[model samples]
Target: MTVLHALAATLSRAGRLARAAASGPDWWRGAALYAAVLALNFVGVWVSIRLIAWNKAFFDALGALDGQTALRQVGVFFLLVSASAGSWLAADWLRKRLLILWRGQLTAQALDLWLGGWAYWQLRPGFGAVPVENPDQRVAEDCRKFVEGLLEFTLDLISGAVALVSFVALLWSLSTFALPACFAGQVTLGGLMQLASAFSQVTTALSWFIFFNRDPAGFVAVCERLDGLMAAARAPAPLPGAPQAILRTASPDGALHLQGLRLATPDGRWLPALPDCTIRPGARVWNSGASGEGKTTLLAAIGGIWLSGEGRIAVPEARFLTLPAGAPVFAEGLAAAACYPEDPATQGSAKLNAVLTRLGLGHRLDTADEAALSGLSMGERQRLGLARAALLRPDWLVMDEATSALDPAFEADLMTWLSAELP
Candidate 1:
């Protein structure tokens, strides 16, 4: 089978490569490797033919009595050497060109597949996706190695097979064919040589198999390593589904509906947000439970961060905004950064200015400097965070102590802004 065919078959059989471990050498993959063996055999036979030719010439020169003629023959040999060297160089150059093109194509395809989706992040920590060790290395180094190895292996097998065939033919012709002796009876050099060569070839073949079968073993070992990494990329299964587990239904206008959302980690498990509760859209719901009540964890579960233990969080078909403790201010322009997740261009300056003014930061519209925002007191940061939320106008905004820094007056003002926009 071709290298492409074997790879396809292996991938198909592996299903979700992340879930199952790869086991044993797939014989189908061995076919292309065997082709490489054939290529190597061809190289061996071709080299052997050159050796035989050199031997013939050396012996003929030794038998010549005239040193002058031998000298002439040596000169001719130099020309022959140069011609052969040039041919070998050209052949090698062609081989490398072909190899590069083949490898480039495979590399591009593998990279595209790997980079697709949140595949990279999914394969990272705490996400339950299988942990691919040294993901960068796998995507960069191993991919290159796989392509090179597959190509070399396949071509070598092809060349080896051709060499084996060619050598057998040449050897048969040279050793076979009946020839009549000048003064004696006819001799069948062909039959004698054929028999001897057959024995020799069989012995050589057996020895080669014993020594070279290690190649396939090594190849499979590499494949297994790659499979191990692939498996590590799959997300761990959701702790066996809860009895009668059901997902909450979301609303049409993108409001978040939280109805008795109760969740607890499984045995021997640790997670935040173990609080059970219900929250309605635009309700200004306050989670007044004490610390460690999993208030933040509750928020996370609702926002779709941790999916391990949960009841149901119905998120309407609208943009959902979850602001953790501190607002993440980027180094970009304050206006642009405030309306993150939505482009400043989309919201426009007028809308941005309105939100900024409402949050009491109207004077810094064109400030462009980040120092102004960063130097703000604690209360100012909360106002900016609120302004950011207002600018985006997300369908659902889940705030975890976002207004903590603001005093009663400012906090009341922030609450008023949120309540006014609730409908």
Candidate 2:
């Protein structure tokens, strides 16, 4: 089966399992504990943000030689640290409690299903379509491992999402144009105040000594230039005209329909108009044109990415996969990299090796580490892209010069295999 088919099957089974688990009597209690754990995690995150702010204040005080303020910040530091530690400890305890509670419930349910339906007799080897190799271990040990893994992965995902949002917000605040303006204003004001104090001192000295000095106009000029540069950087450029209304509708039948299509750049410059056309389902199209002829743009518009044009495009309601000229590889293992968008553990090693070998990439399978997978040559990466398409078996596949790096014979062989496999 294709990866997509297996994934669908897995999801169907998971849905049933979820419904079964939710129907249990103590499901609400388990959910409540889980919610409490998540709430405590949020509290811990808030405390961490507070601690970060405290670090800035403490360091500023130290830099200014203010021992009293520094000592007070240190005291606040301990309070925040205590709150953080307490929140995490409580969360960890609740998490463990929820794990055992869910584990017990799951194990009981598994036992009931295994014994009540006589699955132990029917699911034995050579009896059922998919035999249970070790039903005993599956019932007793797998239940515990499943619950532990579920809770651990779920918590890790939540923490990662929260951290991503926090970092993005911090970066946005730091990068705002207003931040630079604020710093520049403070610096300019300080320089002006110092200049005024020096002028006053020099004037008093001049009255006594009758000495002449050159005017200090250069400092003021430099400040004015700096202000001008900041203002220019903050100024907003004129935006382009509103994009044309390009109505995109989903096709009921598995075909691509383009009617009255005209492409344009974001700045409103028009490209060559495309003729009204309908591509039948399963058609392999090759768009050949000179460079700068908007071929890539046309593909982008068809993919619903670039819509600065006028026309109606009807796209099929099917799984669509796009492979660009430079196929990107993630820092994952070989099987995971090949069968992306699907769990790596779900893909068998033999299948991965077969696909890589078919595409002339089997040699790198053993040698390619997670870090090295991303640094593969262009041809190898393109082969990996083809491998994904073959394994995924999407309904509609789009490529924009995806095989440009491969040699003629090898590309032809890969395409032949894909056509036969995908057909």
Candidate 3:
């Protein structure tokens, strides 16, 4: 009864482990490969059992063998060699293929989540407990390691269970069903010896459980460390409030609203960057501060590039033009420069020159064009950014120190033009 109970428990646990391994998404992704590998692995195990049986038969036959029959063992030796080679090759090939596929799926999932809809940007500002380490390394290097480790773990667990089952069955067959008793220098037997064997097996199993439980504990520790590393790598944004805005054309009257704005750093546990400030529509918002007082950060928050902390930002959907501290220039001709952020093919030359000429950049349209936009001067790039805004005719134009590069004459002309253009 004791032996029976131990076998029943071991079989039950092994079945559960196998079911879990086979049911995961990782299995489905490379189901064919897993099936092949599992089949080969089990076949090898079966062959190994057969080889042991044959070895036993050989030993038993060796005592009664004649010279002619003795040579037949050589055939068994060759069979063992071939079976070993084929089984190993099959198992190894499938292991590598499944691992590669698993890594690929993990990497692809990470890439999609990272690039889709500003997820990377949000991570920088600290959103969830999800790790955002060297995103390049995490997505590229660590993903592969994670997948490979998981694959090895799964395979080892499955194979271990199979090994246990094989060994237990062998033990059952090898053991004699006879009770042993020594009393007064004599021995006596009861019913079958299975109950005594079962008790011994149960004791052995209990000993192994106490010793092996440490492995799972170590695995949990490693998982916790991974989570910690990811948390440490996160870069939380310094700005608060979700920027929800619409293109200018969508709203009859361009309006920008800020409500309950807050901000914090990745490491910060309490204080928010902004203490809940709201800016009404058409307000001449001035974000003045010393260098690095989060002026640029605030502008980025308003531009809908960063979403961290708390609060809400509401704006009529409209075309939004944001000019960073440095402007951006296009390498295309003057027409392309003016129609930047929009294709030049959509706008006529007359409209392009008109906006450029108004911004003191009319002379640039006739210059020799080049493929590299970096060839232009910084001031020239700044003017191009303004020209792009003019051509787009966005209802909301945000200039973040854009005029700092322009001369007084052009700056006044540009601001005057901007004021007039805004209804």
**Clash count of each predicted structure:** 27, 0, 16
* Model 3 spans with C-alpha error above 4 angstroms: 1-27, 60-63, 66-73, 110-142, 175-222, 225-294, 305-312, 315-423
**True-structure RMSD for candidate 3:** 11.2
**Model 3's lDDT to the true fold?**
0.59
1-423, model 3: which lDDT tens digit per residue? Answer: 997985565445434323433444676758888777878877776766666555544544555564455467658757887997898898998889877776676555545556654556766535544545566765666555554555666665676567557746754654443223332332222122333443444344345434543344443333333333333433333334433322212223455555566644444333335654544455667677787566666666667654444556565676778886567555566676667668877767787778778776777656677643546677877877887777787767788898788889878877778777665
Ranking of all candidate structures by their lDDT, best first = 2, 3, 1
Per-model TM-score versus the true fold: 0.50, 0.46, 0.51
lDDT of 2 at 118: 46
Candidate 2 lDDT trough over 10 residues, lowest sum = 230-239
Q: What C-alpha lDDT, on a 0 to 100 scale, does residue 368 get in candidate 3?
A: 71
Q: What overall lDDT goes with each candidate model?
A: 0.56, 0.69, 0.59
How many clashes does the backbone of model 1 have?
Answer: 27
Best by TM-score: 3
**Once superposed on the true structure, which residue ranges of model 1 sit more than 4 Å away at CA?**
1-148, 166-235, 238-248, 252-254, 266-283, 325-392, 401-423
Better of 1 and 3 by lDDT: 3
